[model samples]
Target: MIRQIFLALTLAAATALPVAAERIGDAARGATLFDRQCKACHQIGDGATNRVGPTLSNIFGRKAGTVAGFKYSKSITRMGADGLTWTLQTLDAYIENPKALVSGTRMNYRGMADASARADLMAFLRDYSDQPANIPESEPTARKSEPTLDPAILAIQGDPEYGAYLSSECSTCHRRDGADEGIPAITQWPPEDFVVAMHAYKSKLRPHPVMQMMASRLSNDEIAALAAYFATLE
Candidate 1:
C-alpha cells in the first residue's frame, strides 16, 4: 500500500512539472534578463532616446519599424507597412529568431533559443512599455505547444567564431591583448572562469555599472563563445 502511494505521488509531481515550467518567465527575473540582453542597443522607459536601436518605451501595439528618425532595415519597414504590431505573441516569435521572421533586419545579435528567456523578455518589455498587457501566471495551451531550451545547454554548444564576431563591441573598453589600468586581463583565462565572472556581473554579484550593463546584453551562447575566445586569446 505504501509503495502504491509513493508511486502515485511521484506520478502526480511529474504531471505538475510541465505546468510549473510554463510559468517560466518571472517579471522580476525578466527585468534582470532584459538588462543583460537588450539594454546595450535599446532603451526603454521615460526620456528614452534612440541609440543603436529605437527606444522601446511603448513598443507593443506600435507598428513595427515606425519609430521616427530611427532607420530600419527594408524588411522591417515593409513588414510594418504591411501591418505589423509589436504584440506579445509577435514579439515572442521575432525574438526567437529575427532573421528567420524578417530576412533583412540589421539587428546583429543572434536570436534567443530559449522560450522561457524570450517569455521573460516579453514580460519585461510589456511592463516597461507605456501600455502594459496582462500575461497570466500560466497558460496551459501555450505551455504545451512551445518548446524550450535550457541556457546551460546552449552555453555548452557555444561557437568560438561567433564569439569573436560578438566581441567587437566589447573590445572598445576591454583590451583584447592585455589589461588596461583597472580592467583585468581577460586573456588566457579558463572558459568556465570567464562565464562565471560574467554571470556575476550580470547578476549584480559584482558591482561595476559599466560591466554589469555590458554583461546584461549577452546570451548564454554568446557568453560561451566569448569565454572560449578569451580563453584562447593568449
Candidate 2:
C-alpha cells in the first residue's frame, strides 16, 4: 500500500513539473518593451493612426499588408495573396526577424533577438490584436522560399553616379545619413532592399500614394540607379 502511494505521488509530481516549466509571457513586461522599441514606428489600441508603420490593433488573423490606409511592401502583400495570415506564430517569427521571414520587407527593423522578450512582446500584442480563443502551441519555424525578382528589374546595372542625381527627390523626406525621424532612414541599406522597396511602391503593392506617384515616374533602370546611390551613402 505504501509503495503504491509513492508511485502515484511520483507520477503526479512529474506531470506537474512540465506544467510549471512552461513560460507564459508577462503582458506587463511586454508592454514596457513595446513602448521602448516599437512605439517609434507603430501604434496600437485607442485612436492610433498610420505613422511610419501601421496601427497594430486587431492584427492577428488579418491578411498581411491589408491594413486599410497603411502602405505595405509588395513582398508582404504578395504573401497575403499566397494566403498568409498573421497569427501569433507568424508574428513571433516576424518580430524576431522581419527580413528572414519576408525578404524585401520595407520594415527596416533588424529584429528582436531575445526569445523571452519576443514572447513578452507577443503577449502584449495579443492583448490588442483580435486573438483567437486558443493560441497555437508552436511558433512558425519554417521560412518560405523567396520568390524570384523580375528579370528586367534584375538585369539593369545600377549606376551609382547617375543614382546620386536621382536621389534629390528621396533626400527631401529621407535623411541621406540614415537618421531616424518619423520617416525611416534609407542610408547605407542593401541595394536590393532599396530596389525591392521602390518596385513595391511603383506597383502600388505598397499603397502610399505619394510613393506610388514618385516610383511611377522612374523606369526600372532608374530605380536600380537610385538604389545604388542610396546604398553608397553612410
Candidate 3:
C-alpha cells in the first residue's frame, strides 16, 4: 500500500512538469562562451572520457556522476547508473550553480548566472552532435488520499502552479522519482516535514555544505511554496 502511494505521487510529479521548449537563449553565443570559459575543464562529445573533468556530450541525459577516467573525490558512477537524467531546467540550474546542483561534485565552475547565457548554453548543449539519449523509468505508485498537509505549512503554501514551476530547480538532484537509488525523493514528504527538513538544512543542524548554502539563500516564502508544491505531488 505504501509503495502504491509513492508511485502515484511520482506519476503526479511527472505530469507536473509539462515539457516545453524555451527560446530565451542564443546557441551561437553560448558556443563562443563555452570555448572561452568551459573548454579548459570539460570536453564536449567525448563520451564518459574524463581528463580534468567529465565529458559533457550527453550531459542532459546523465545522472550525477564522475567520469570513468577522471579521479573524483566521491565515486558518482552509481549516480549516473541510477537513471536520474538531467533535463533542460536542471541543466540551467547547474549552470547557474554547480555545487548547489550537486552537493559534493568536484567541478569548480562558479556558474554563469546570466539567464540568456545559461539558456544559450543549454541550447548549444542539447544540439551537440551525438547519439540520442533517453531518461530512465519514473517512480511507480497506486492511488491514495492526499497526505495531510501541516497547518503551518498550509498558511504559507504559494501558488501550487508556481511551486510546480520552481520545483524544476529541485529535480536536478532530487531525481524525478523519489525512490531512485542513493537519492531521496522529497516530493513524497508532507509540507511540515519539508519545512522542518529545510530548516534543518538552512541552519547548521545539517552538515552538507552545499545544502546549507542553498537552503540559507531561500526565503521563508520560497520554502513555504516549495513545501506546499512538493506535498501536492500525485
Candidate 4:
C-alpha cells in the first residue's frame, strides 16, 4: 500500500511538472529563438534601441505603444490608450496571433504558432523586464527592410469631403469618436501614416482579413481621402 501510494504521488507530480515548466520556460533556448525569429525587427537587453519594431528591453509590464520615438500604428496606440499592458498572458495571446489581439497591428509577422516556442520566446523577453539597473548589454539587432511607397501616391492630395462620404463603411467597425473596444480606433491618425497603413493592408502585408478585403476594394484616391478624413478627427 505504501509503495502504491508513492507511485501515484510521483505520477501526479510528473503531470504537474510540464505545466510548471511551460510557464517558466527555458530562457536560454528562448534567446536563440529570438535571434532567428524576432531579432530582425525587435531589439532587447541593454543598449537596445528601436529598429523596425520598438525596442523590447522592458516590455513585459510596459503599456503597449508607449515606447518613445517610435511611430506606432493607430491600432496599437489605441490598444495602449484602452489599457492594454503587456503581461505574460497578454503577451502570449499577442505573440500567438497579433491580429487576433489588435486587429490592425503593424507588427508584420504572421505570429508564432507553436505554444511552446512562444513560451520560450516570452521567457527570453521576461529576462529584461523589471530590471532597469541590470539589463544585459546585448548587441543591437538588425532592422527589417521597409517597403518603399511611390512618391506620387504619397503626394496625392485627398479631399476630406470625399473621405467623409467614404468613411461610413469604415465607421461600421472603427468608431468615429476613437474608442477601441475590440477593434482598434482609426480616428486622429496622421494622413501619411494612415495612407501607408491602408496601402499595407491592400498589399496583404498587414494580415487582417477584413482590412485586406476592405483595402483591396478601395482606389488609391479613395484610401487617400479616407486618410484625410480620419486625420481631421479630434
Candidate 5:
C-alpha cells in the first residue's frame, strides 16, 4: 500500500510540472530583451516621445484613440473615439497579434509569439516609464512633477530623468516586481526592435489609430531617449 501511494504521489507531481514551467517575465530580463530587440522603434518615460512608432509610455491605461499626432487608420481612430481603453489583457492580445487586435493598425511586424517574451517586454516598458514614488503605506502622496502633455504630442528625444518621471503611469497594468492581474513583468528586449516598431506605427505600417496618433506626435530625438531609458530599467 505504501509503494502504491508513493507512485500515485509521484504521478501527481509529474502532472503538475507543466503548470510550473510557465515562467513569467522579469523586469530585469525584459529590459535585456528590450535592449536587444526593441530600441529601434519604441520609447517611453521621461522626455521620450513618439518616433516611427507611437510612444509606449504609460500605455497600460491609455485610451485607444489618444496619442497626440499619429494619424491612425480610420477604423482604429473610430475605435478610440468609441472609448476603448488598453488594459493588460487588451495589450496582451494586441501584442500577440497586432492586426487581429486592430484591423486597420499599420504595424507590419508580426506579433511576439512567445507569451513569456511579451510579458517581460511589458514589464520593462512599465519600469522605464514610471516616475519614482516614495510609496508610503498610504498612496505615496500623488506624484508631483508629472507630465501634462499628451503622450502623442510629447517630443521623442527623451530625458532619462524625465523618462523616469513619466514612467509612473505604467503601474496601472504592469507590476515592477512580479505578475499582477495576469500582467507579467518584462525586463528584456532590444532597442533596435523597439525603434522599428515605432517606425512601423508612425508610418502606418502598423494599424493602431491611437498608436499612430502618438507616433505621429513624436520627434525622432525623443524616440532614442526613450529607448535609452528603457535599456537601463532592469
Candidate 6:
C-alpha cells in the first residue's frame, strides 16, 4: 500500500512540471517548420554561419545581443544589459511577438500567432543548444541592412508646435514622464531612431496593430515632427 502511494506521488510530481520543463514538442515537425519559416534569415546545425540573422547554434541559455560580431539594435542590447537571458520562456515570448518582447527591435518578423507553431520552432531551436564548445568562431555577417531613407525626408525640420498638437493622441498610452507601465516609454528616444521606428510601423513591418494604424495615417513630415517632439522629452 505504501509503495503504491509513493508511485502515485512521483507520477503527480512529474505531471505537474511545466510543459517547457518537459521540453514538449516534436523535433521532427520542428525541423520542417524551421525550414519553412526561419531558413531565410537564420542558419543552424553544423557549418552554420550568420546570414541576415545571427547563427542559432547554442542560442538557448545565451544572453541576448551577446553574440560577438553581431551588431544588435540598441533595444535588444539594453534588454540584455538588464539581464535578459535566452531561455525557453523568453525565447517563446520573443518568437511569438518580437516587438512585444523587445520594443524597437530591428527584427522584421511579424510574429508567429500559432502557439503550436511557436512550440515546434522552439523545439527545433533547442536542438542547437548546449553545444557552445563545438560552435565555430566564424565572423558574423550584418543582420539585414536597413533601407536608406530619402534625404529629403530625413532633412525635414520638424515643427515642435505641430508635434505638440499631435502628441495629445500619443500621451494617452505612453507616459510623458517616461514611466513604462505595460506599454514601453517613448520619451528621450533619439530622433533618427524614432523616425525609423515610426516608418517601420507605417510600412507594416513592426507588427503592432495600434502603432501601425497610428503611423499609417501620419505624413512623413508629421512623423519627423513627432520624433523631434518626443526626443525633447525629459
Q: How do the residues 118-199 of candidate 5 rate in per-residue lDDT, one tens digit apiece?
A: 7687666655433335322221111111112233433344566754544454445556453556754533335544454554
* Each model's lDDT: 0.69, 0.73, 0.61, 0.76, 0.56, 0.73
Instruction: Report model 1's TM-score to 2 decimal places.
Output: 0.47
Top candidate when judged by lDDT against the true structure: 4
lDDT of 6 by residue, 46-124 (tens): 9898788888887877889988788899999999999998865677778878998999898899888766677677777
Model 3 global lDDT (CA atoms, 0 to 1):
0.61
**For candidate 5, which ten residues in a row score worst on lDDT?**
139-148
Query: Per-residue lDDT tens digits of candidate 3, residues 158-206?
Result: 6667778778888888875666677678876777778766755664344
Query: Which of 2 and 3 is the better model by TM-score?
Result: 2
Clashing pairs in 4: none
Model 4 poorest 10 in a row by lDDT: 138-147
Tell me which residue pairs clash in candidate 6: none
Q: Which stretches of candidate 4 lie over 4 Å from their true place?
A: 1-23, 131-234
- List clash counts for every candidate, in order: 4, 0, 7, 0, 75, 0
- Count residue pairs with overlapping backbones in model 2: 0
Order of the predicted models by lDDT, top scorer first: 4, 6, 2, 1, 3, 5
lDDT of 1 by residue, 1-234 (tens): 112211222323433342322332567777888788889999988899999999987787679999999999999999999998876667776887888778899988798887667777776776665531254432222222121223463358558899889888778877997777777777877887677667656544445688878877887778888888878875
- Candidate 6, which segments miss by more than 4 Å at Cα? 1-21, 131-234
> So what's the TM-score on candidate 3?
0.44
Instruction: Report the Cα lDDT for residue 6, model 3.
Output: 25
Tell me the TM-score of model 5: 0.45
- Which is the better candidate, 4 or 6, if ranked by TM-score? 4
